[model samples]
Target: WNYQFLTQLGYPSNYYAAGEMTVSQHLEVSGQPDPYNPGWVGLDYIFGSGMRGGSSGGPHIANLGEIVDSATDPGQFPDRNTIFAVTSWGYGLGNSSGTEIKIQGASPLSGVANANNFVDLFNAACRRSRAHFGTWTCDLLVP
Candidate 1:
């Protein structure tokens, strides 16, 4: 799904790099539910090279790069934020590559009074299932 849904739920999207500049990267989201918290859903993708080392995990450990918000309140949504960690493999690295996206909040999801409300909104949107690529996800995060 696109970040628009996340923004609709009041979440910000952050980006990061995984390894060297040569490695290609992207984001993926599935309607997977969080096994640890059924009340919460999950979106997972490989971050950087799952291979480890050789510029693995990129230059930053916690890359909270940017934030995008809706133009309007959009009604009944909590203020949530998403942080992404990305990694890549150099040319000819073979199958030595992977990438990941991590969605966290500036504050704990449970701490936000509107947390459940936003989750409900996200679930409603997920029924339609929208996926995007490149930096386009950034636009989706804002209105």
Candidate 2:
């Protein structure tokens, strides 16, 4: 988890204040609705993390590794550093006194079966960028 300020009661402080956690659960496209907060939806992946505040929009990347621009082999899945989701919300298992177990969540960036996918969104942004700049700026990264 990435945050600017560490507000959790028992959480420690460090430079950059960033940490990574393994995702435990992945909710489906249907998502979970909160009864406590009306019209609020929770369609995200759950993981164990101590990050509390100022980390809402951090990226949740999958297959993260070194950028291998190999001379022999281009390597498998060029988009290995792709961000699958972004941090949404989290909570701790305790009361106002203190927290015991910390858990975090992030909503997926794209679902394979979804009508409006990440590719569409990315393309739209690229188109808009080209329209304004008279050149395809995104082509350098994607193409």
All-Cα superposition RMSD per candidate: 15.4, 9.1
lDDT of candidate 1 at residue 113, scale 0 to 100: 48
lDDT of 2 by residue, 1-54 (tens): 222211111222221353443232232232555535788765555666755666
lDDT of 1 at 112: 37
The most accurate candidate by lDDT is 2
Q: Pick the candidate with the highest TM-score.
A: 2
User: What would the C-alpha RMSD of candidate 2 be, to one decimal place?
Assistant: 9.1
Per-model lDDT: 0.33, 0.54
The list of candidate 1 runs beyond 4 A from truth reads 1-19, 43-143
Alpha-carbon error at 9 in model 1, in Å?
27
